[model samples]
Target: MLETIRGLLEGKPGDAPAVLAPERETLDYASLRDLCDRTVERLNALGIGRGDRVAIVLPNGPEMATAFVAMASAATTAPLNPAYREEEFAFYISDLGARALVVAEGMETPALAVARRHGARVLRLRVPAGAPAGWFELEPEEGGGAPRAARPGPAEAEDVALVLHTSGTTSRPKIVPLLHRNIVASTRHIGEALALSPADRVLNVMPLFHIHGLVAAVASSLAAGGSIFATPGFDAIRFFRWLDESRASWYTAVPTMHQAVLARAARNPEIVERRRLRLIRSSSASLPPQVMRELEATFGCPVIESYGMTEAAHQMTSNPLPPRPRKPGSVGVPAGPLVRIADPSGRFLPAGEEGEVAISGPNVTPGYESHPKANAEAFFEAEGRRWFRTGDQGRFDADGYLTITGRIKEIINRGGEKVSPLEVDNVLMEHPAVRQVVTFALPHPKLGEEVAAAVVLADGAEVNEHELRRFAAERLADFKVPRKFVFVTEIPKGATGKLQRLGLAQRLGLVE
Candidate 1:
């Protein structure tokens, strides 16, 4: 297996497409590899090298994708969401202690000012209109010689290739450093699980900064010697157009994106027929089983639901391809990591028992970067192996399928009786009037926490709290029914479009 991002292009035909931007010239494997070499040389000239952190903020597309891979090969790549505000950029740049910042030639983002405040060298990336997608020239700021490092070659397995922050929906974000081997191991695992080959082409619409797009889409495709049609970002209106024109063999998206695409599917028959995807992948968040079935019925292909997080380097488990039993509602068996169930004290649990999901594998990060308290709580020594607790509550079936119940910290405790929001969500999704729903915990004066939900009703289908409560009461116990129902047109989502169950009550003005 390829141990570094640079090695992913090895042995592939130079003419095979590697990265594609919408209406832009394709960068083939040879060109991509050459571009990486040139980019590394430039980074070297600018005094960047292995273990040196370089923060990158660019629009979502081929530039971002190639920049990540190329910069990560020689330095620690810290990709920030371009949508971040001044405060967020300043915090991340200072927290990362980045030595340099890379931005588009004309990009006037607040990150530039933030970088200046931190004294991080700012470099402009220039891409000609006619040049291939991955081609770009790095221009240093006027008259600047940045800090220099001695190391200037391809990194080893132990080198940190990527650094990302936790979404921190509940607390302060922690930095996570992923080694080259961790990501390489994860990429190979994903490519193997998806049965990727050079014949396959993936349509990438997820944001490049996220782990799902970096490892699950770009790195996996490169490791397989396949190709990527890197769209600007997820746009439901232009989704079918890209799918058809690119002739994508498969594509991956979050649950929200999949729901949006499914909403527009009935109006686009020709596009659907023209690009018959071999499979569909949903990750970064739990895929509602109803949406999964609808996608399969519409696309006539298997919809593989995978489990991933930033700390896992992207993929942990995934539903296998055809001939293997695909279980609905389960994130499937462990694809790469050795997944097990454990109690809070780190005792292993048996099958059919619900507990925290623990994983130990090469794909998992060594630990959180320099956070001893987080490391102590996140990792534990059990049975002669170090296991990283995934913070997710799940169980393994007799057949070895994993069903994620909910996050441990997000589970609702109504008068000491535990309730799974996912169970409540599943029951509510069965309602004909419910289109999208998020089950969360509301502050209760006496009970400490009460069940609550924010729901988006289907078009022209209306339902009130009383009716939804009645519907859930029939399928669930009294304690499991939502004590408070907020009929919202849309639920609040995080940066990556994941429903953040934690701290939602305060955001909705339900709690002081």
Candidate 2:
């Protein structure tokens, strides 16, 4: 695997555009590399280099994309969600022990105050007008904090490139430090899975703070000497327009964003006709098979659903491209790492058996940072390989396809009857009026946990709760059917746009 992200640009045509921002001049390979070198030199001069953490808080787009590539080369980059509140920012900044903060110049954010309270230096980046899309200059604030590095330079394969916190739906977020090897391995895995080349251009709609965006969208494309048409964020209205205008070969997004695009796709037939997409990928969440069918039917392209997490640096498994069969609901074969099903006793399970999903590979994180207890619990030795328990319940088919049943903690236990939420969601989505559905465990005094579902109806389509329950009853066993149906215009999503199935009961006020 390539040692550093900066090395991905090597051997490519220097004048070819690598970073494309909407309405701005694209950053060619030469300029992108130049910008990366300059940024690292500046960070080194500021006394921040390998082993030091710098928190990045910038809006989504080319700057966010390029900043990640630059900082990871010289220092450990921790990209934080800009949507965080002051309190959230305070905790993350303090937790990360960030040596400095990176935010766009003149952009006010709560991260500034949080960094100040922690005594971390603030480095404001300015992307001057008419410069390459990703080109920016950093200006350190007056009275910066003490420098951490004696001499700064590019990092080695063992050095941590990026540090991210887990979503922590059930427990406190765990810090995940990804080394240069892990990132490079995952980037190459993704590029290979998608068959990326210099001519392949990815239209990035995922959030920059997330591993899916950082690795799948930016790193994967750049690794293959491809271009990334970076967007500010996902906009359903503008999605088709961008696809048509950019002539993007592929785009990867969560199911929620895909549903949003589907909702508006009916009105954009011409754009769909003109847009010839080679592939459409769904990740970070399961793409309901119903939505996948519609996407394929509408666009006449294969919808590849892949499995990923921050722990694996992004891709763990992915459905192969054309000429290889793609199972509709399954996440497909392991694309990057060695994946298997493991029992509670840490024994690897055989095919057709359900258990916790475990992965061991170069891309897997060495371990969670600074948390001995978490590291002990998450990693274990099996088959002479160190496997990290994913906490996801799944099984491998005889044909080697992996079907994720549910998160171990998210499984609904109704009087000891374990229920898979994905099964229920898939059933409910079969209803013509049900556009999107999320099945969750609702608190029940007698049964401990009861199955409940929240649904977003199709546009102008009305189907009552009774009809939906009856529909599920026909397809599922009685215990697996959702008892309570909560109809909402929109389901609550996390910062990176993934639907939170574990804590959804609290978010819906169905549990205390």
Candidate 3:
């Protein structure tokens, strides 16, 4: 496997466009390589190179995409969500021990103050007005921290290329450092799973700070010598227009974004008719089977749902493209790593049994950084191969199709009767008025926890709680049915647009 970020871009046609954005000129492969070389040289001059952490805070766009590839080639790149508050920024900057903070020129963000307080240098990126998309130069902020001796070159296979914090839904976020080998392996895996080629173009709407966007949307496309149509961020209203403009062959997004696109898609009939998409991908969350069906019907493309997480770099399993059967609810077969079901005692389970999902492969990270306790709990040796427990409860069919029941932690325990939230979600989605639904555990005084659901109704749709409860009763057992139904126009989402289930009960004031 290729072991370096720089290696992912090598051997491609130099003149082919690699990065593009709405109304911006294209950045070709040759120019992109040049940018990486220059960026590495500049970082080396600034006394920051391999082994040093550089925290990046920038809005979603082509520049963020390019900066990631370039900085990873040069040093360890930690891309933070730009929407973080001052306190959040302070925690991440201090936790990462970032040597420098990279932000767009003239862009004011809380990260600036956090970096300054930590005594980390600030590097401003300048994007030339008429330059191609993703083309930029990094300059040291005035009065930046003093320069120290630097290793000064592209990172090696063993060097950490990217560091991302786990979502930390149940515990404090752990730092995950993916080596160059892990990233390259995952990149190639994604490219192969999607059957990508130089002519393939992806209209990426995922945030750059996330593993799904950084690897699946950017690295995979680039590795296949394909182009990325980078957007500022996901805007459902403008998605059709951009799709028409970019003439993109495909796009990848979370289920929430896909739902939003579907909501607005009905209004863009002409664009939908003229656009010819080869495929659509959904990941970073379990795309509800309802959304998957609607997406395939609306766009006239296969909706490929893949399973991923930060520990695995990104992709773990993906449904194969045409010629192979694509199971709607299942996340498809293992596309990148060797996946298996493991019992609580760390024993690998055979097919047709539900247990925790585990994986072992080149793309899997070595372990969580600086946390021996987490490492001990996460990684274990099994069947002569070390596997990382994915914390997801799932099972595989005899045919090798994997079905994710739900997050092990997110499964509802109503008087010890286990209820898979995903199962409840699929049942509720059958209701005509329901556009989206997230089933979670609500605190129950007697049972300890009860099943509850937060639902978003379709446009102009109306359904009383009693009616929905009745609707659920017919499809689910009494224990599996949601006792409380909270209807809202929109469900709260995380920074990267994933529908968060943990802590949702408290956020919705249903924790009593």
Candidate 4:
């Protein structure tokens, strides 16, 4: 069991590949460990050391992956989305009280200006020509304070390793700090769930800024002595080609990416056959049973759907691989933490009863950083243990398989009856013409809120609202069926490619 970031790299064979990218040299474990050591020394010299926050704004690829691992081992790392505007960058840099900002050489982003204005040192990540993927040097810019830090060394197991803000769909984003112990526990859980080993190679397309990508795809793979093929980002058009080149045994992504790959799987039959994946993993959002079934049929591999969030490092529960039954709709049993259903007051709920999902374990964060009110509402002491509420409504079956119905804030209340958008979305997905569907709440004069859906039809497939409503009505209760259907080419997705239901009504112009 890896207890710290340094331990994650030390046990791996020195000569084994740790990171790889398309058409780039591979970074071996020995060099990767050396990078961490050198990176810590450089940061110490620059006055940024353990407990200091370093904001990384770089495009997704080997550099982003490598920087995260090396920097987190040295100091606290906060990776912001490179696509953020100046205002967004300003808010995060200031909110995090970042000591430094890191950007790739020749890269242009608003973070550069934001970092300067916020009094944070700007460091340019320079990748040497013809260098191994993920090898880089950090050069400080001409501004910021002198070289000095209170704590100067590699981070300990209890030191804060990563910090990320909540999506804040309903309110202001809250800071979540994860210790090295939290991440190491999570990576061990993911590695164990997937049965990872040195022979495994992962094709990672999830954005490096997100927890799913950072912990599940990068850290877990490296911790298992496996290598990850990092990509620029998720590009549906270029997925198969990369798969063929990387020869990855498996890959993990959100459901949207899986659907996109399935859409293009037919054109690249040879590549699909040549790279017969060991298994496919989905997380960050619910994986529709419809999409899961299609993915398994196309890839001829088991589709392992997992549940995760930033508050819990990354993975909380996952469908086990092989020999064990993988439930289609359920996120499967607890993989890393003690997952359970709790009532409103925090008491445990019996199996088969719907309630808020709660977890308590080593991977769970201590609490939200510096926000006492939010922390009070987010955590509760129960059964002699502190459990963090997941804000997700779910229930467990007799067999202990957990099925998440919907987000607590995302559930639609029609007059008095509660409706889960996920339930409606699942039924609508059963329609042959529906490629993707996001069920949301549209404000209604009498009902307060009415169920509506945005549907994306499959290629050359057509269906009217009446036909789709009829299909959904057959499976769902009348109140749960979507009353209004809006057909579109593509449903809008969040930065991490998740469909946001909380504000979808306003985003789609359905709210008036």
Candidate 5:
């Protein structure tokens, strides 16, 4: 992993300009390398070394990116969102057994208070204006016994590099430990599937804290010797301007972001034409086929939808670039490793059969950290190979294209009939007035559970429960149609910005 990071620092011929930050200042290959080296030195001086756990709580920006590369160079990097509350921070800090917590200088973040409560060392990162100032800072303990020396040894392929918390949709988040081999394998596959090269320039708006941004956007780009334009967050207006000014060739984001971009495309035709993006990548959440087609038509580029999770270290599969017949609803073929669908009995189902998706490869983590129950239930041995259960239902078509139907737990059961909430949501999204839609299960006296939907209408557009239900009825069966519709300004999202289906019923007072 360190070798890959170092290799990117040595700019190859035909490489685009160094990675830029429209939000912050840009960093060339040499400068990024120096920052990584110095950060390693600082960490070592603070008694952190190989295999130690260091927790990071920062926003998405240059500091977050630099900190990730630096920590992975020496010790295990555990990056968490800065928005976590005090209780949430306390749980993760104590759970991960972190040796130290990294935060911004003078910032009163929850991690700092949680670190002090758990007796974990607190490291303040100072961000310089011109230079990378927010680089991690290590504060030595009082009466420090013998300054610990930093180990400059290379990271082994099997060494654990990152420990991430799953996006707790149904329950509390579990820690997923990813090894150096996992990172390298997954990023290499994504780079290959995207045909990334030194000539490529990626416009990365995804949050750095998630696997999608860390590996797919940053790591993959670096591995390919390509450059990235890192934005602090997704801004539709600024995104269009940067797309033109930076001349970014490609970009990656989630479905919500794609919708926002598509909304702005009509006003930004000149910029889009001038930039001529190679492809637009979507992951994390399923992208509605309607949105995919709209984005492609608006931008004049293919929208590559991918299947990924935190346990897989970002990407499991991606739609092949042009000339490969990008499927609208399909997530494309398996990219890095072997992908299969298994029935409830743990038997592998053949192609064209819908079942639980399982993956096996170097990119897939061995198991969760200190999560024996999850490990036992999620992993299974088949044909002398260990496979990780993705808990997602999917199948391969005749052409080997993968389409994820929905999550196993996210499926809504009406009476005894099984219905995919994603299927219902996708149909509702096509309504002219519907801007965003989330389908979930609501409790019913007779049916046990009934389908319910929450929708956000487009600006100045009017929609009612009667019209919405009528719209869904046209595309779905009576049982599949939502029994109740709730018009809301926004839907609730989890920490990673994914819609939480299980909690929606309870939060909306639909369950007693």
Candidate 6:
């Protein structure tokens, strides 16, 4: 399992750079391997071993990446966001049964208090000001202490490598433990789909805590012996500069990040001229067809929309890179496993039929950690194989391209008519004044639930409720048009950085 990561640090192109950070220094294959080895020794000296859980509360950057590799070498790694509040940290730490918490020196967040309260060992690493948040120089123990022993040989495929909490927008977060085999299989599949090789370089701006960043961007690059430019965060200015500096061949991010990049495209045409990007990947949230076209036009590259979830490790279906038609709105055909649409009764639906999506693959997780009820409701036997029910509504086109319509739970029930908020959102987003939009259901005494929308206008743009309602009315049915329109500067996003629809109404005071 570690062989993939190890190989990337050993047998890559001699001139290829293994990792490029936003600032500070870059590391070649040899340096990266040495760092991982030393980091593993440091962690082992702290008493972390196989089966132990090390809670890593850090941000994106080289340190977080190094810590992840080091911990996975010796124990289960749980990387959480540093922005989480005290209550959130408490819940996650307890839920994962973390034995130790790694924090940056002088971090004043509630995570530090919670970690101490839980009696979890706290190790402080010193992070330089311009360095990545989660990354810090691990100073050798005082007085030249004895060197720690090396970690054991490669871990078994079935050993749990990572334990992460789901973005619990509607309910309590659940722990999702992914085994080494799951990571290997998913990363290998993603690398193959992208046709990544040692010569390819990726510019990764996504947060490392998310599965998309960990598996799709970082793990896949390592598995394929490719290089990655790890950005501290998504900065449009720095991103374009790095694109040319690192000679990045491809990049991956969420739709929102893509929109930000497109917004800045007109300012940086020189980067495109110098270093042409091969492909742009989008996931985590649905990418609108309009934005996809705009991005492809601006970057002169195809936008590959992929369908994925944390439970499936990461990529399930990705639009083929080239030689294959890139569907505008569809996520494309199943890439590595059996994907089928299932009705509410668990019966498999025929192609081109809208229903809940189900998947059975080697990359899929066995079940949620210690959550028997979730396991019972989420998985079922189909044709002697266990299939995971994804609470998403989608259908396959004649060409086997999967187009996700909406989440089953997010569908708005206006009287007896069901309305897909995503369908309405896409149309509303087409308006020139509409910068960001989210459609949700608000509780109503008469209609049981009414369609409502929250919108963010572009800079210096204005659109009244009446104008917005009229715009949506032209493209949607009466029931589908939002009954209430609320304007806001921005929409709230979860830890994974995806917009949440389940509890938006309550949070915005639109519903009781």
Which stretches of model 4 miss by more than 4 angstroms? 143-145
**TM agreement with the true structure for every prediction:** 0.98, 0.98, 0.98, 0.99, 0.94, 0.92
Question: In model 5, which residue pairs have backbone atoms overlapping below 3 Å?
Answer: 126-133, 127-133, 127-134, 128-133
Cα lDDT tens digits, model 1, 316-419, are: 99999998988888999999989999998899999999999999999999888779999999999987889999999999999899999999998999989999
Worst 10 residues of 6 by lDDT: 140-149
List residue ranges in candidate 5 displaced over 4 A: 1-17, 23-25, 132-146, 149-152
**Tens-digit per-residue lDDT, 1-512, candidate 5:** 43334344455543234567765556666666666677677777777777778998877776787778777777788898888899988888988999888877777887887898888788777765566322334554434653574554434566677898877766888889888778888888999999998888888788877899889988888788787777677787788987986788899888888888888888988888888988889999989889998988888888899999989988898889889888887899999988999987789988899999999998999898788998999999997899999999989998889888899998877889988988888899899899889999898889878999988888899988999999889989999999899988888876556666777988887676
Give each model's clash number. 0, 0, 0, 0, 4, 1
What is the per-residue lDDT of model 2 for residues 298-384, given as tens digits with 9 covering 90 to 100?
Answer: 999999999999999999999999889988889999998999999988998899999999999999999998899998999999778
Off by over 4 Å in 1: 144-148
Q: lDDT tens digits, residues 331-449, model 6?
A: 88898878999997889988878999899998888799888999999999989899999888999988899988898888888999999888988899899898788999899999899
Cα shift from native, residue 347, model 5 (Å): 1.4
lDDT of 4 by residue, 25-75 (tens): 999999999998999888888899999999999999999999999998789
Put down candidate 3 lDDT per residue, 1-512, tens digits, no spaces. 25788887889989998999999999999999999989888888888989999999999999999999999888899999999999999999999999999999999999999999998889999998899999998888875555653677788999999999998888899999999999999998999899999999999999999999999999999999999999999999889989999999999999999999998988998998898899999998888888889999998999999999999999999999988999988999999899999998899899999999999999999999899999999899988999999999999999899999999999988998999999999899989899999999998889988999999999899899999999999989999989999998788899889888988999998755
Q: For model 4, give the 10-residue run with minimal summed lDDT.
A: 141-150
Query: Which segments of candidate 2 are over 4 A away from where they belong?
Result: 143-148
Per-candidate Cα lDDT values, in order, are 0.91, 0.91, 0.92, 0.93, 0.81, 0.80
TM-score of 6: 0.92
Model 2: lDDT equals 0.91
Better of 3 and 6 by TM-score: 3
